[model samples]
Target: MLQSFMNVFTTLGDTVVVPIVIFIVALCLRVKARTALMSGLLVGVGLTGFGWIINAFTPVVTKIVRQMVSTTGINLPVVDTGWQTSALVSFHSTVGITFFIVGLILEIVLFLIGYTKVFFATNLWMNWGFMIWGTLAYFVTKNFWLSLGLSIFMMLYVLLTAEVQADRYSSYYKINNGTVGAAHNMENVVPAIILDPLWNLLHFDRVHLTPDALKEKLGILGEPTFIGGVLGIIIGILGNIRRLGTLDAWGQILGFGVKLAAVMTIFPLVAHLFGQAFKPLTDEITERYSKGDTKGLSEEENIKSKKRWFLAVDDGLGYGEPATIISGTILIPIVILLAFILPGNKTLPVVDLVSIPFMVESIIAVTHGNILKTIANAIVWFSLGLYMCSYIAPIYTHAVAQYGVALPAGAVLIASFNVMCRPLNGLIFLAWISGNPLWIGLTIIVYAAFQVFLRTRRQQIWMYLKKMSDRNIAPTSNSNMASEIKKQMIKS
Candidate 1:
């Protein structure tokens, strides 16, 4: 009965279900019923529109990656089953159906104890990411408690990171109450901690290739539209270089370029509509609870405001930003090339390659849209994941194969870069299944220490992000909204 219900829930997908949840949350927050209803519909529309833009280009990009691989005569053993396979395998398990409940309880408990300021009960579907590791851990040990513990730990890790990074996301992406809560996105805090100092020491933080920065220096030529078109042309050339002399090839190239250009132009407008969807609920929460001049808060309201709670929403909110798009798209071909050249990497990174934009939003947001740093961070992360996905492909294959999923012809094993999620997650899983008490203890200690750092050093983390991010400039496209954001960011 639980499995049957789970199937129906997963089948409904995000666009259909998330908006309904949003509406209910809005009403619970005491927002107007009419406004809540409209907000819900707008969110659904925005998600659908994002789906349309992504779906339109995905097949094309996937084909290009496959073609590039074929032309280069590269062979990788593990098939890239993408996140659909990963999520389905995850949700099919005993661990999956209950992870949402566990994660929510944990989130609420942490918030109540003042250990985390992130309220992530919204967008619970994203919690499926935890079960990827949970599913894999279960397959290895067949131990339910251990599997559940891994999932809970992954959730706890992200909740803490999300709280620490909330100020940066709001200040940089101008999403107000929204902070990236996607496990794939928040897990990036791992790399940022390890390598961010290197980026600073090398002075990579000084160069800004974000769209707004470009516009300031080069005028209209630096506009996102122009940048998108140029990036499209580069991708076109990469995909069609061998056929450059043919007329049809030029047509395909230019047409592909124009398609990307269209996505670049249309995505922000779509994103703005999505952000507007949350305005009513966010405004109500802020006005009702904020201890600031907006309202004289009761004790409860003051505690709520002082906690500085942020909504852990989808990364899709910032996925449309120019730097986010560019950083992910540019890595498409590089992913293929690296797959061939990187030692011990057996996964070809097919379907997930097209979904790179979703994976990089948090990194881009934290860097304040520093395209160079974002790409640099992504390349390192993806390279490591290639090895991780390859190492775990057999177990992942075994985990999902029980479902009797239709395999692409001649495929034996499969994995997803996203299932690797991040190096820290991969390391945690490795230690758990290693059967080494020392490794397990070390992993626990490291994770516990990191969580403590996020909890205690949040202000220091925010200061570092502020130093890395641009200031005294518009964070959002709307000048008035940007001014308000600037004021809030300053006061904070």
Candidate 2:
């Protein structure tokens, strides 16, 4: 019965459900009915636009990838059946059942206590991200409690980490006040953040490969619309290169390019609709917080009262930027090459390659869409991720079989790029299943430390990032200045 209800719930999907949820939440916040209605409708329409955009691009991109794969003729032990199938499998699992029901309850409790401030509706259905790791943990431990506990911890962990980066993401993409609450957590981002300075050290940041950066060098040619068209044409030509002598090859190439260009051009417009959906809430929240006169309050007291809550939101809103589109699309082929060349990799890069953009959205958030750094960071990630996915293949296959799901004919095993490459989640799950007191204790310490930093330093973090924004620079992940300020912030 739970699964039946879930199925119906999912079928209604974000477009239908988000608006209603948003309306209800807006009403609860005392939003005018007309404004609430507009917010909800805008959200629904915006999401529908995102769906259309994704649907339009995916098939063409997949077709291009299929050609590339056929040409390469590389085979591997695990087939990438894509994320939707994996999400479906997880949603049907015991872990999914517990997370959807229990997770919702936990979120409400956390919000009421001021432990968290995200409106659950903004990230609707994303809570299923908790189930992916939970299901994987269940595969190793056979204990539902362990799975549920870890899943809950991961949710809290991701939220805390996401809170730090959320404002930067929103500011960079011009999305309304929301943080990424997607499933592919930010584990890999730690290394990327650690290594980011090298690019600056090498003066590669001067090239500023992001579209915004390019405008400095090339003017109108660097505009996102133009860059999108050029990228589309390049991809079209490369994807169909082998068919050069074929009758309709040129037609196919130009058609794909034009379509891609159109999609890219349309994204920011759709994103505007998306932003409009939540702007009313953001405005209200900002106004409410600024009220109740700051007459005699201390600086700290005033700052605390004026603090803003960033809702957890979808990755789709981040897709509008040209850098995000370019870097993610480009990663598909990079993942393919890494699959073929990376030593000991047993997972074939296939369907999920198309999802490389969404997969790397978090990276884009941190890297601020700097193409060179983003691509370099992602290459390292995929290099390690391929092997990790390969390692998880057997358990994934068993989970599918155990659930009476059939594999594709002639497929030996399966892994999803989006599923198994979560480095931190994988570490935590391994520690739990290892049953070593030391490992479990260390994991606890890690979460506790991050929790302390995130919860305690929210204001400092916000102020620091805001200052960076005021300086007209993308927020550095962890600069020397930032580290020093944080040190002082903790003491204060």
Candidate 3:
């Protein structure tokens, strides 16, 4: 009975599940039924469009990477099946349903307690985050209860990170209508958090390298589509140079470049559709909550005067930003180069090549859309991903074999950047390898301490801003909204 229900529940997929949740939430918030339903369906349509774009690009990227590997003759033992395969393996686990249920309960508890405002129930498919931890934990300890606890703890960690970071992203991106960015690529969060202080210490935060800056510096060459095209052409040439003559290589390069340019060009349009789909529901909810109480205020002032409410959406909407796409495009060949040069890097990144935008989304956000800073940070993070993927490949292979997953002929091992790159997963793998539970315990402790520190630091900053506001010194609109949102989050 339980298995049947689980199957039925998951059968709808995110295309259906996300919209249904949005509709239900909108109705609960007193949005009219027709408006809510339309908003929900549009959101689904937008998401489906985004998915189609992703699907279209993935095969192209995979073919490119495979060609590069075949040309270079750099064969690593572990096959890189990427996140899709890893997610499938994770979701098929017997413990998968249990993790999803527990994660849902924990998400609700966190939201109700004001620990987080972004309800992850809306992104049900992302429960693979919890499943990864649970499946790995069970593999290590062969104990169900321990795995369950660890999965719950991992979910809590992700929620807290999202809670702390969401407002900053929304405010910076000017994503109006109370929408909060929720990322399933929690691995990116670790590097973002770790590097943030370093970035500040170096005063790199003062540097802004936005698309406008790029345009001013390099004209058409700096445009995202041009950058993507150039990079794609370079990759294609490099991939085929050993196998094809110069003219043939150039032909492949031009063809691939055009395709890549098209993908980058279409990304932002699809992303806008995604953002638009949520706008009506969010606008309605925000309006209903505000009750036209601040109609006389300035446009900026109205944003400040509004109370805090959150509408959850996937972080992918921002992945289409120019800086992110360009940076990610540039990183594809760089990752391939690093695989050969970086010591102990056994896994060659293939399928996850297209996922670079999502992987670097948070970094791009925190860097304030600075392409240079995002690329610098991504290089470091991708280096870590390579090392971590190498470290976990053996265990990953063992777990897959243990679960009776079939492998390709002569492929005894598999690993993925998407699975092993997560800081939480790295920590779990370390604990298992060391045969000491203390490492995992310490990770939890450090995570909890960091969350507390973030909360306290936010409060202190807001308190200072509030003092300025009281003195009639106006803060910037984004800062003002951030302050207001923080206060509301705390009060809730």
Candidate 4:
């Protein structure tokens, strides 16, 4: 019966599952039936379109990566297939369905307890994060029940961390009440949180550099599309120069330039569609849940009285931003270069190159569109990421092999940024290697401490947001300005 249910869920995919869940939630919140249905359908359509764009781009990126690998003759012991491969290994495992069900129940429970305001239903497909943990735990303990238990604990850990950052995420995205934040890629959260304070300590957070600034300084070349095109051309020239003549290399460069520009061009349109889908739902949530009689309430009370809930959405929503894509594009050659030069680094970041946006999104948010800061933060993050990927490769290879996934020739291991970048994974790998339960205890304690620290720093975070907005030289959209004004009013 469970297997049948899992098959049905998998068949429906995110397009169906996300819409159905959103529709149900809207109805339960007393949203009008027509509005609910329309909102749900819009989300489905938007997500479907977004997924199509991603699918279209993946092969283009993969081809470039393969070319780079071949031309460079850089052989590593592990193949980096990125998160997509990991997702496949995860969902195909024997316990995939069971893990999904357990994760869903845990999300619901967390929501009911007010431990999380973001619903996980909208991103049910991202349960691959849970699957990664479960698979790893099973490999370690050889006990299914214990593995399931550990996976549940990890789910709770990530959701709680996400909840702490959701307010800032919503503010940064200027989504207002329209959408909630989710740590869809849990791997990015731990590193981001750990590194955020260091970014501030270095005063990089105060350095304001945006794409618009680049445009003013460099003219047309600074435009995101142009920059993307240039970066693509550089990468193309580098990758193909070894294999093709100068003329052909330039042609390859231009071709790559156009493809990347296309990707940059299409993303924002998809994001706008997603925003449109969420509007009705946002209106309904605000109207139904906002506190009544707010004239004399204190600022804190006023904010508290307003609805705290948001429609949880995927981290893919972050990719639509130009800065993210620009940063990711710039990082591709840098990452490849690092793979070749960075001693002790075994994994080339080919497959995960496209995922740089997801990894860098949180840093982008915290830095408030400072591309320089974002890039700086990304360098630190991915440096750690390279090491983490290397550390987890053997364990990941073993777990996947158990599911009949074969490693490539001369490849004794496998790893991806999306799977191994998490501090949770690092701790687990340490625990596994040392055969000590102390590492697990230490990880839990550190996570718990971080949450408490975040909860206490809420006011400071709001102040930081205010300061960042004030420093922003780019003109704010009316919606963003209004959101800022509303936040200010509440604080006052």
Model 3 ranges with Cα > 4 A deviation: 177-184, 196-208, 244-248, 289-309, 402-404, 432-437, 459-492
Residue 430 local lDDT, model 4: 57
Question: Tens digits of per-residue lDDT for model 2 on 1-492?
Answer: 878868877899878877887788778777788888998898889889999988877788778776777676677878888787677767888887778778877876776577765555456677777787788778878888888888888788777667666666766676655667776745555655666667667765555577766775689887776776777677667777788888687777778778777877898789777887777776665456546354455534433543556666667776766888788777777788888898888988777776676776666666666778778878877787788788878888887677777888778998788767666766777787776779978988988887788687877865554443333243334466799999999999
Best candidate, TM-score: 1
Q: lDDT, candidate 4, residue 455?
A: 58
**lDDT for predicted candidate 3 compared with the true structure:** 0.70
Ten-residue segment with the worst summed lDDT in candidate 4? 177-186
- Identify the runs in model 4 with alpha carbons over 4 angstroms from their true place: 178-207, 216-219, 243-247, 292-307, 428-437, 453-492
Residues 1-492, model 3: lDDT tens digits: 546756766687778888887788777778989889997888788788888888887887788778887887778877777777666766677666787776777776776576765666666667776777678767867878777777777677777666555554555555663333333455565566567667656755555556656666689987878877888888887778785667766777788898888887888888787777777776777678778665465434543442444566776677777877887877888888888898887877888877887777766655556666667777887787788788788878787677676776666578767667665567654664354678767877888897787555654432332332222212245676999999999999
Candidate 1 residue lDDT tens string, 1-492? 657867777789889788888888778777789988998898899889988988888887776666666766667889896888878777888887677667766776776677777777767778888877887888899888888888888887777777766877776677666777778887776676567778877777766667777887788878777777787777777777787899977787787788888887899899888888877767667766664543555423332345466776667777778878878878888887888899887887888887788888777767778777887887888888888888888888888887776678767778787667467788888888776789988977877897878666766666666665553234445766779899999999
**Clash counts for all predictions:** 0, 0, 0, 0
Q: Quantify all predictions' global Cα lDDT against the true fold.
A: 0.76, 0.73, 0.70, 0.70
Number of the candidate with higher lDDT, 2 or 4: 2
Against the true structure, candidate 2 has what lDDT? 0.73
> What is the overall TM-score of model 3 with all chains considered together?
0.85
RMSD of 2: 7.2
